[model samples]
Each structure stands twice: as structure tokens, then as C-alpha cells.
Target: MTGAMVTGAPETTGYGGTLAAEAARFAALGWMRGTSGNLSVVTGRDPVRLLVTASGLDKGELRPGDMVLVDEEGTAVPGATAAGKPSAEAALHARVVRLTGAGAVVHVHTVASVAMGRRRPGGIAFRDLEMLKGLGRSAHDEEVVLPVIRNSQDMSVLGDRLEAALDPGVPAVVVAGHGLYAWGADLREARRHTEVVEWLLELQLAEERGR
Candidate 1:
């Protein structure tokens, strides 16, 4: 697919196609089953344009037409064929991108992540794990704290709180009772972060259960 144009208006097709591909890959992994996740890619820099998954579509069946183009304020731009309204957490995605200057944001409801978020004290810790290096940590000895924010239906309020709690160096955060939100300079890095975090959560859960 061609790179998205940086025009202030929506490059709906380009962004939508990218989201669809990523969504399908995540869905196949069961990380976003039954419309439980959303993905977005920044299509423009100036004025900040984004293409994100629309609400209520089955993630496993996501199509290029199943996405919507929105401005920085989360409003749907005119003339773009949006599949439906943008995801309820669109504001959260916008906040992350605005704060981190990330190119893409991905959220998923993996079983391991949900369980770990529920049981983790304060936050999940990845220490002495080789996977920690995947997240830009220089060494396995480093302790990386993945911030865990409380979940709420009031996304505006939640988004505000999350933005306040974010640590610029961290690439991902977990929402209590919800799921994981991860981002990176591009989709591959973002997805890799998600995979590493999910794996760490599973390992932590297993260790706790054995105790």
C-alpha cells in the first residue's frame, strides 16, 4: 500500500488498509476476539490525521472498508467512507499519539493480559527477561513498569487520567479490568510490544499460581 498523504484531509483508503491488515493479524491470534480491540495509524503529521477501526465490527473479519478517518479531535472527516462511528476509545488513542508522537496505537483484550491486570500489584513488572530488550530496554537487568490505569466507561475522564500517568519512555499501558494499549513508531514495533507484554503477563500468572 502507498504511504498516506500528509494533507489535512483524510487519506481514508491508505490508513484503513493498514488498520485492516493489523486487525486481522491480531484477531487471528485471539488477542482481539469478537470486536474486543481497535487499531489506528497516523496518516498525517500536520493537523494530525488518524485512521482507526470503527466501533462494533468483528475484528477477525476486519476489512479495509471497516475503518474510519478522524481528525485530532476525534471527529469524523467528511468525504471518507467510514464503516461506522469511531471506537469509543478514540480519544485515548489520540492522547497517546499526541503525547508520544507514536505512529500507531493498538489495543487488545488478550486473556493473559486481562488476568494479569486484575491480579497485579500496582503494576506489572518485566525484570531480567530477554523480552524486555524488545521494548527498548538496554539490558535484561532493567525493570520496566507498565503503567496500569483504572478502566471506566467515561473515556474522556479515563483518557485524561491516563495521559497524566503516562511515562514517556514506556511504550505501553494496561487499563484495569480492560485490556492493553500499546504503540510505537510503526505497527510492527507496536505489535511486538504487545506480544512481549502478553507473554510476560502469562509467565507472571503462572508463577503466582504455583506459589
Candidate 2:
């Protein structure tokens, strides 16, 4: 929301610790490359403040300093110096937190997720998979629909559409041709959701190919 500034990596007590550790893990798995995905943690709730990674930093080498402070409106906060602007998709993260009471959000681009999202008019459907339980199902036969919405360059439109498309009871959604947005009550759950959703997407693709 304002001119970005610079800061050092964050300490172990906060979001910096999670980002520094998790971002690289996702990168090693080939999920984040070319600085393509964004992650955030809700640092404050009343005013909706967050520590979001600055745009264009390689996730493989994310550091605490690489994170920026921003408000619910996605405006850069006065402190928590930043090396770059928050990711362009920061608005989507804010929306998820506001709408879902999510404490952390993870967005990533992966091939299977992108391909599946592209063809699903409303959303992608998953069923008869053991992984459904990772999304909070009681039975393997349960169905989970990962909602899909058209991707756009306009944050306002994307934010609005994504909000309307979201199911807070679920873990993730798809921004068509872009990728997956996953969240949880905390950073650990959010990370697990992202991993499980990604695995489900890849498995769905593999099964279809086998068929």
C-alpha cells in the first residue's frame, strides 16, 4: 500500500521462522520456483495485520527479512521493513483470513493443480481417495470439491471472486491456470493442507492417465 523498504530476516519467535523453514521445503519439492508462490501468517487480527513474503524472492532461500508487514487492505505497514512489495496475490491471502478466520495461507503453482483447474467449470471433484481424510473427511468414499475460479490480473476481481468461491470448511481452492490456495487455522495446518492438496492433485492426474 505504500513504498516498500528493507529489513533483515525475522527471528525464530514469529512468521519469519516458519517461512524460512517451510518455503525452502516447498522449493526443494519443486513447488516454488521463479518466486512463483506466496505465503503469509496472520500476525494481528483486530486490524488484520500479516507478515507476508515480499514479491519475487526465491522461496528456496526465504529469510525472515524477506517478509513484509501489511494490513488487511494489503497496504505495507510502517514497520517490519521490506525488501520488496508484497506478492501481487496478497489480496487473496487477506480475503481468506478475513472470511475464514485462517491464521495462515499458502498459495502455490503446480502442474497437476493448474491442469485440473483449467478444465473444471465450477470446481474439481475428488472422491474415493484415501487422501480425502487429509482434508478432514471421515471416510475414503467421501467427496471433496476443490472450488475453481477464473484467474485475473485484477486483485479486486480476483479477491471478490475467490471469496465467493471459497468453502471455509475445506482446505483449498484453485485459481484456474494459476494454482492452489490452501489455508488452516495455523501455519502447520496450512502447510499440511497445501501438501495434501498438492498430493491429491498429482494423484488425480496420475489415476486419470492410468485409466
Candidate 3:
């Protein structure tokens, strides 16, 4: 345990490659510019282990070895590897999974999400958009509210607020002036939820500007 380590040897699995690809994809879309975002996938459920993107690496350039295994509390597990530290927000990601039973989580910075979160710190509500279906919601007349929680330097404080505001029906939440966090049953679903929520926020921002 003197050196870095992970359980079940995730390095031998495809988790790293999957995370790297997703990070690169989001980076290309400008949501994960530089090293500002992180993505993770659940590797175990009984004790809740995950493979999260290591901290401080350029999301656009993450490699197959750029992942760290962490426990339910987001503490890196001691085993055997050189994978760097877990993302600063790894705890929040873990909390999301515990709360929602999501298999993957995507946290990213986006202009629309930041702007909307800042403007509506209480929460942002959406309805009557076909895109709602993408979030697994009714697209006709029902409402979907994406919770917004104030950002905190302490992950514990942030996590507590997130828990208080989380809507079981919603797969996404915005950290005011920070970014958005989206999760789903898996990486692909999480990515789709992120994109759909971001699109909805963009549309709302545009409508507000026009008003």
C-alpha cells in the first residue's frame, strides 16, 4: 500500500478507455474544456466502488490509465497503480450515485448551465419541450425541475445541499456559478442526459434574452 492502488484491477478493464473517450468527447463539445470536468462509472454496487477521472489531467487528453478507483466516500482505494488522485468533486459524484442509483455521472462546466443556475439559484423548471423525453420525462405538459445548489469549496457542504435539493425524477442538477452534474444508468445515458439538460437550459436562456 505504499504506492497507488485500486481494487479488482480496473486498469485491466475498459473503464479507463471508456472514461477517456467520454472526457474527450465532452472536451470537444467545449463542456469539459481543459481540466475542468470529470466523469465516472460505477464498478461495484455492494460497497459502491467507482472509476473516476484522475484530477488535474486535461480532460481532452485523458488516457486509458488516467483513472482512479475510489470508494463510496470518494477516497481512493489503496491497492497498486500509478493512477493519480480522484477529481476534487468525486465525493459529490459518489453522493449522486448513492442517491439516485446511477451507474455513471458526468459533471461539466457549460455557459448555459452556469448562467441559468446563477439567475435562478432556487431551481430551473422546464416543460412542454420534446427534449424532456430525452431526460426520460413527459414531453407534453409535465414539468421537470433541475435543482440548483449553491457552490461550496467543501465537498461535504456541497453534497449536503445537493441532497436537500435533489429531485428523484430528475437526473441532473446545476451548481450555481459552477456547472452541471448529470447521471444515468450508464455512460451513454448520462451523456444524453447532460446534453438534453444543457440544450433545455440554452433554450431557456435564449428565450429570456429575447424577452
Give one clash count per candidate, in the order shown: 0, 5, 2
What does candidate 3's lDDT look like per residue over 24-116, in tens digits? 999999998768989999888877888899999999998989898888998888873468899769999999889898999999999999999
lDDT of 3 at 56: 94
How many clashing residue pairs are found in candidate 2?
5
Tens-place lDDT per residue, model 1, 54-130, is 89989888777787777787667776654679987887888788889888899999877778888873788778888
Candidate 3 yields a Cα-based lDDT of 0.89
lDDT tens digits, residue span 1-211, model 2: 1112223334534567677678888888888879889888887776687778789889999776788777897777775564578976887788888888888888888898898887675888888877778878754666788889999998889989988888765778898999889999888899999988898889878888789
Model 2 ranges with Cα > 4 A deviation = 1-9
TM-score of each model, paired residue for residue? 0.91, 0.91, 0.94
Clashing pairs in 2: 5-82, 8-65, 9-64, 9-65, 10-64
Residue pairs that clash (backbone atoms under 3 angstroms), model 1 = none
* Candidate 2: C-alpha lDDT: 0.80
Residue pairs with backbone overlap in model 3? 5-79, 5-80
How far is 139's C-alpha from truth in model 2 (Å)? 2.5
TM-score of candidate 2 versus the correct structure, residues matched by position: 0.91
Show where candidate 1 strays beyond 4 Å.
1-3, 6-12
